[model samples]
Target chain A: MVDENVSFEDNLKELEEIVEKLEKGDVPLDNAIEEFKKAMDLVKACDDKLKDAQDTIAKIVNENGEIVDFDVE
Target chain B: MVEDYITVSKVTDYIIELFRSDSNLKHVLIKGELSNVKLYPSGHLYFTLKDEESQIKGVMFGAKYKLKSKPKSGTKVLIKGKIEVYKNYGNYQLYADEILKDGIGDLHRKFEELKEKLNKEGLFEQDHKKKIPKFPKRIGVVTAANGAAIRDIITTIKRRWPLCEVMLFPSLVQGERAGENIVRQIKRSENFNLDTLIVGRGGGSIEDLWAFNEEIVARAIYMCNTPVISAVGHEIDFTIADFVADLRAPTPTAAAELAVPQFKEIRNDVDQFNSRANLAINKTLNENMARLDNIVSKKLFTSPGEIYAPKEMQLDLTVNRLVHSSKSLIMKNQNRLDLAKSSSVFKNPGSIIKAKKENYLLQFSKLELLNPLNTLKRGYTLAKSEGKVISSSKDLKSGDELEVEFNDGNVNTKVI
Candidate 1:
């Protein structure tokens, strides 16, 4: 399982590695199926992480576009 | 003995009065080169006045010493005062009330002497000098708080490095207490952890810069771990502090400039580095992406399995044809073999043998019609003599033995 607590940059790096491996296309059929499943999961994870960051940033900016500090959950 | 038969106190008083009332000795101007001059802690001055002929001891009490500037050994000066007698030591000394420089002043001599001494000690050696900081976060200045020099330093530091913090330690730059004050400020600035120290004041005579020239101030600067920059007086002016400091600037403004680097220039350099790095990374990424695009557009990537498709189809077709033709050829050959087997004449050997036997029997019947034995079966007799059959009368001879054979019996006969 990927650690959600990892920094966004680290997660992005891992995602890039996954994409590169999939692009190489030398995996065995069974391994390829497994990698494909993992890639799908990683894509969703990255998307979720980005969406969470965007929402947090948005919350920081009010309708007037003024920055404000907020507490973490 | 009778002339000296007076009380000791009275005699001493009389002698002191005689010396004090001497007109030539009182308020007289004496010219000589000064030597062994000392300014005592009591604020009194003591020295020996000497000439080519003789020497005389002189004393300037605190009252008069305070009224005039301090002098040192080898100073050529004229003193206006009275010649007085010391009854205890029985010595005559000059009590100077006024002193003036007849040639070079004693202060200058002392300045030169100290300069020479320190120079020989290698305190002014260039190898000991340290480089001033290019950028100082905070500048520690040791000067009179209200002096023009401090104001100038602050203004220059603000104009050059606005972000830098300026701290001041007020000190008396001239006087007997000046050296101690300057040293104290230097130590205090060190405790404050100032990035750089500017210890100096505005232009002045050698007397004014005397504090900086003092050994105490020099030692303080030398011991300070923080970088020290001395800006004393004008460009031509130098002091002991200057030699001991890390750097010497001509003026306070120069010191400020030396201490702080231009922020704009640094910002420009940083921006340039960032832009160059970004361009390099972008170029790298673009090249990598172009290579990836080239690989993706290649035939192998379009359909990775297409390379083997033709061979696989060829194999499939060949196998099908082989199976179909092989089955048909096997059936055709089998049919030909069955037809040849069914029509074969040599299959029944016993029937051929029987047919041949029947043919032989018919031939034998035909042959039997010509047989003489058959005639004998029809009641005709055959005679023979000596195993010979007689067929005609000519064949029979008188002496011949004849035998007659019937179908069922044999008979013997003689013919004559």
Candidate 2:
């Protein structure tokens, strides 16, 4: 079974790569169809990931052993 | 023979002449740990050289100091210069002409000083760093024009992406003046519209790569708007410029690879995309055609207009049947009328009237055969007076006349 919890960014990146490849027209017909299917699946996975309520911040302990919220900036 | 009292001017002149003429003190070498190093606004260098016992004041003029590489305080160095006396304050100092680092140098201290200065100025901040292009149109190289680094970069770029244009801004890569020259070329290459900069020479010792480690070069790299990829020295060696650059490559070839994308891979991807799109379009067309065929083969389509046709045919058949039955009914009624018309009383009322007239005549004849009129026709006469016929003469009056009648003629006679 495929992993349902794949990261949104990873799925999006894969989809973009597939789109780029498709636009570039370098793959064989069979491979293109396969990649297109994978791309569609990735698009759906990305949508699923975004559909859930988001967790704003993640906390991790630094080298000093103090927990801190990850600062996006 | 001895002037016990010498003038101040004469004493100063004598000391100056002695320092200038004294060959032994002219090139004497002194080893000491440096301290109190100060660079004046006039570009002159002032410092103190101290050993375990004592310290000596030293001054290196701007011209000589500018030629020497930077040396930090607490660095151990050997100085070669003459000792001279200043008459103004009557102070003795060493006016140094040459200075060289001696023992384990103060590289770490210099590195920390540069790092701190640049960091405070925000050179190492993420905001100041430029992003490397994913696909560079042109790559500008700032290295020795004929060095191995340039060759490596060209070869690597050609191998990865043959379409990218590589332009070179050649500069001195190793020496006292290398730092300034490298910065100059980097600025010059900016006008060339380079997507990224590859600034370095081949692998070398620390001293050889010292130009790249200079604060000026690091600042230059940081100030450049274009993304810089520094590939100085070997993989083990890193410089301050590398830290400040947008990216750090372990070798010159690696930097070239990072500058451009692979053409072959991109082409292959493009082909794949075309194939996929073609397949999808074909599939859609085929599916639509199949649906159309299915609709055409359905029973309703096979016999078109059938729903209205049957009703029309049934109406026509009923109308024909009605017309035939009505016509036959009318003809049968007409025949019945003809038959009634040909019957006796209906055929000729005049003839019936004639027959009735004959019957009446025959009845009248029968009455005549039974009556006296017929006897009269046979010549028998009955005479009557008044309203009654007289059967005997006893009823006759003496003066009365009697009359007799016949069927064709009537006759009257008088009785006496």
Task: Indicate which candidate wins on lDDT.
Answer: 2
Model 1, residue pairs in steric clash: B383-B403, B384-B403, B385-B401
Cα-based RMSD of the predictions, in order?
A: 23.0, 23.7
Query: Taking the tens digit of each residue's C-alpha lDDT, what string does model 1 give over A14-52?
Result: 555555554555545456556555555555554564333
Write one digit per residue (lDDT tens) for candidate 2, span B244-295: 9899988898888788666566544444544654565456456667878999
Identify the leading candidate in terms of TM-score: 2
Q: Please count the clashing residue pairs in each candidate, in the order shown.
A: 3, 13
Chain A only: TM-score per candidate: 0.60, 0.65
Top candidate by DockQ: 2
Candidate 1: where are CA atoms >4 Å away? Answer: A1-73, B1-131, B297-299, B302-416
| Residues forming the 10-long window of minimal summed lDDT in candidate 1 chain B | B269-278
Which ranges in model 2 have alpha carbons more than 4 Å from their true place?
Answer: A1-73, B1-104, B298-300, B306-416
Model 1: which docking level applies?
Answer: incorrect
Cα lDDT tens digits, model 1, B348-378, are: 7788888999999999999999998898888
